[model samples]
Each structure stands twice: as C-alpha cells, then as structure tokens.
Target: MNTTPFRAGHVAVIGRPNVGKSTLTNALVGAHVAIVSPRPQTTRHRLIGIASYSEGQIVMVDTPGLHRDFGSANATAMHKWMNKAARGALDGVDAALLVVRAGQWEEADEYAYQALQRESLPVMLVINQVDRIVDKDQLLPYVAEVTKDREFAAVALISALKRKGLKELTRDILKLLPEQEAIYPEDEITDKSQRFLAAEMVREQVMRQLGEELPYATTVEIESFEVDGTMLRIGAVIWVERNGQKAIVIGKGGERLRDIGTQARLQMERLFGTKVFLQTWVRVREGWSGDERALRAFGYHD
Candidate 1:
C-alpha cells in the first residue's frame, strides 16, 4: 500500500523569449498543449498544462516570455498584452522555474530573476538547452556564476528538447508544492478548448513555414470548429497586416497555403486523436496587432 500523500500546485514557467519554456511545459505534461516555434514571442497567452504522476501532479502555467520592450515606443498593443499575460501568471503560483539558455545569462535574464524575487516565491533555475553545449566541464562554473548573487531554492540543468534531467526537476518541483489531492484529472492535459488549440495549430505552422518573412503582426482566428462523427472540421483565417503579406502567405498558386493547412491538419489529428478536415484562408487586417479593438476581435484580450 502507498502511504505518501499526493502533492499538486501551480508552477509558473517564466523566462525570456525562445528559451524553451513552452518546450519544457510540453515535455513535462507529455503532450503538446502549448504551441512551439523557433520564433521569439511565439507564446502570447497564459496556458495551463497538467502533468500527472502517481504520487503527485503539477499544474504548470506556461506563460509568454517576460520581455522588456513592451514599454518602448515601437511596442504594439499585442506586445503589452503579452507582457501582461506573463506577469499575471505569477499570481497564486506555488513556485517558479526561471528558464534560460545553458551558457548565457543576459540583462533580460536578470530582469526575470528580479521579478520572481519580488514575489518571494521558491524559484528554481532551469538551465535549458544544455545538450547544445559542447563543453560539459564549464557547466558547473556557469551555474555558479549565475547563482552567486541570486537566491534560488534549487538549480536544474536540463534539455527540455531531449527530455533529459526532467525526472529530477519534477521531483524538486513537487517538494515545493503542498500535500493534497491532484488539481486536475490524470487524463486531462490542458485547460484550453479544442477551438483555441486548433487556431494555435495553424499559427504554429505559419510561424514555422514563413520564418523571417512572416511578421509578428500575424495571427489566426478560428472561423468554425465542428465535429462530424469522429472527425473534426476546422476552418481558420490567417490574418496579416497588409495585402502584400497575404500574398506571401498564400504564395504562388496557393501552394504555401495548402501546405500550411495540410501540416496543421496532421498536427490536429495527432493531438485530438481523430481525423481533421482543415481549411485555411489568408486575409489582411491592417495593423490589427497594434489596434486594441482589432486585438480584442482576434482574441487578444486580457
């Protein structure tokens, strides 16, 4: 018979842009609840990923990257909203994991550390992308330098992409949580709806396929999501800021749009565990990312 109590609580995965916060969240939850791309600021909302174990469960709050440029003159309404979403995730979280690249710590990293310190919560320094480092011997000294002036409850060197050192990280995180029943059911993986996930699936492909050609002003809106038998029929509108951008997304003879839909549909099928019939269309919404009203219409509200 098992005598240990089950522990569960929310842990905020906080970090700068493109530091593998979403990757870590997905790895821990054992599902792709949060979308991922190589682009910075890929995550714009606060998502809850539930990771369940026999002894405990972790309700991970995957938030947008905490960036400093939101207050700048060039910052858009979406930028401010992203920063707001990131900061808001800290509320009511039992602990935080400050994720950063293995061999790099910059001013942005220090800013994130300061924000977490202000909350007075137990913070664990997660050095991600350690698999990219060629010199493993320098890891110890790098960790020491980062932790010299800052107070961290624990430090973990992990490769969220390769799924290395996550077991120990989970164990340390569970220690910070209170002893209680699971916050969510074991089978549940995320707190988002199928419709929302569907939109994100399309956006992920857009970000991945377009790369630098795609502007940050781009977004996706689910026009329709209906279930027919065991299959899901999803329609998404890819919104760009200009007609030229729309042309770029559609590509010559609409081949790019077709590829995007095909890839996104395959992802939906894998995640939803059913056949997905997806339709995608590119439309222009002039400067929607900078317009507050447009942002709200596209589901960017706080």
Candidate 2:
C-alpha cells in the first residue's frame, strides 16, 4: 500500500496573456473553469481550479497575464486592475507555474518573469504550446536559455491544448505539495460559483461574436439567477462603456444581441445540465472600467 501522507498546495498560473493559462488550468482540473480568448487581457480575474488526485489535490489559480503597461488612457484602468489581481494571487501560494509560449518570450513576458523572480518560492517553468513547435530540435535551446537565468525547481514541456505531457507535470506538482489535508472536497473542480461561470460563458460568446474592441469594452453581470428542479432562469446585463459600443453589442435590429444570448444560453445548458432561459441586455456604463468605485461595485477590485 502507498503510505505517503496526503498533500495539498496552491499553484499560481502566471504568464503573458493568451499563453494558454486558462486552457492549461482547464486541462489540469479536467474542466473549463476560466475564460479563454485570443484577445489580450481576456482574463480579468484570479480564478481557482482544484485538481484532485489519489494522493492529494492541487489548487491551481489562473491569473491575469502580467503586462508592462495597462494601456492608453482609455484602457489603462482595466489592465491596471488586471496586473494587481495577478500579483495578489501570488501571495501565500505553495508553488508557481511560470508559463511561456513554446519558442519565444516577448516584452509582456518580461513582466511575468519579473513578478516570478520577486517571489521566493518553488516555481516550475512550463513551456506551453509546444504543439506549435513543428521543429523539436529548436525547443531544446530555448528551454536551456530560459532555465539558465532562473532557478525553477521543475520543468514541464507540455502542450496545454493537446493535453500532452500533462501527467508528468501533475506528478511533479504532486511531489512538491506539502503534506496536509485537502482544503476542498474531492470532487470539486473549482472554487468559482455557477453565477460567475455563467457570466463568463456569456462574456466569452460576446468576445467571439464581437471580436475586436467590442470584447474589451464588454462585461457580463448576472443580475438574476433562479434555479428550480427542472430549469434555470438567468437574467444578465452586458455592460459597455459607451453608447456606440452599446449599439454594436445590440447589433442591427438586435440580431447580434440575440445571437449572443442564444449562444450563451446553449452553453449554459451544457454547463448546468438543465434547460436555461437566459435574457441579456446591453447597458451603457460609461467609464465603469476606469472608475475605481464602479469597478469595486462590479467585483473587480478596490
């Protein structure tokens, strides 16, 4: 019999935006808990996803990608909050996963690298998106170059999209976890609530449909969520910063809005495993992103 003591630890996933942090978190936990988009700054919050194992559980935190600058005056607030949120999650975590795209590290990645260096904790250098590397020979030099600068307790070369080499990474993470009882239930995949996930699903569809400045300007708030035995009644407001953005979200004759709702509703059904009646509206919340008070009210940050 394996007599090893139970282990549990929190691991923060940090990197540049779109480095597959959310995708990797989903693969590690075996569920979709964080939102993923091709757009930079897509992740606006720090989400915790729990991965259960026979010997222990790894509590993984998916954080916003660190960026050098928030943005121009218009976008500064959102990305500023994102940087704070990502930094906040690093505190008190047992270990860290410093994710990087397969063969290159850009300027935005420098922000993440700096943040990780500040933390006196064990970190694993996770080279994600390895599947994109058609030439395997080139990967070795890049990995070797990165490892020389910092001390990473472990190294995981895995394709988070293809789910390759994930088992080996999980094994290393398990070994690093401190001996302690599990903090969450065995079957729980994430600490996020259904309402939050529902909101994210809606936001994701909006991002996909809008596909530009529209995605950054949009935020989904679940105004009401009522559940009965057979179905769910969900009401959400898609908040935008300007009147023009609102019209864009609403689309011609409300067709775009309708499309967003229909797609969100279908995804909700799959997530909740029940019939869903979802209502979405485009509301203009001017300067909400820049307004600290407004952001705090919307659960962004103080």
**Candidate 2 lDDT over residue span 1-302, tens digit each:** 99988899999999988899999999999877887778777789999999999888999999988876764355567778998888989999999998999998887777787788898888888999898999999998998988786788999999988999999999999888899999899988888899999999989888888868585888889999998779999999999999999999998999999999998898878767799999998889898887787777777863
lDDT at position 238, candidate 2: 93
Q: Model 2: runs farther than 4 Å from truth?
A: 71-75
What TM-scores do the predictions have? Answer: 0.98, 0.95
- Count of steric clashes across candidates, in order: 0, 0
Top lDDT model: 1
lDDT of 1 by residue, 123-188 (tens): 999999999999999999999999998899999999999999999999999999999999898899
lDDT of each: 0.93, 0.87
Tell me the spans in candidate 1 whose CA falls farther than 4 Å from its real position.
none
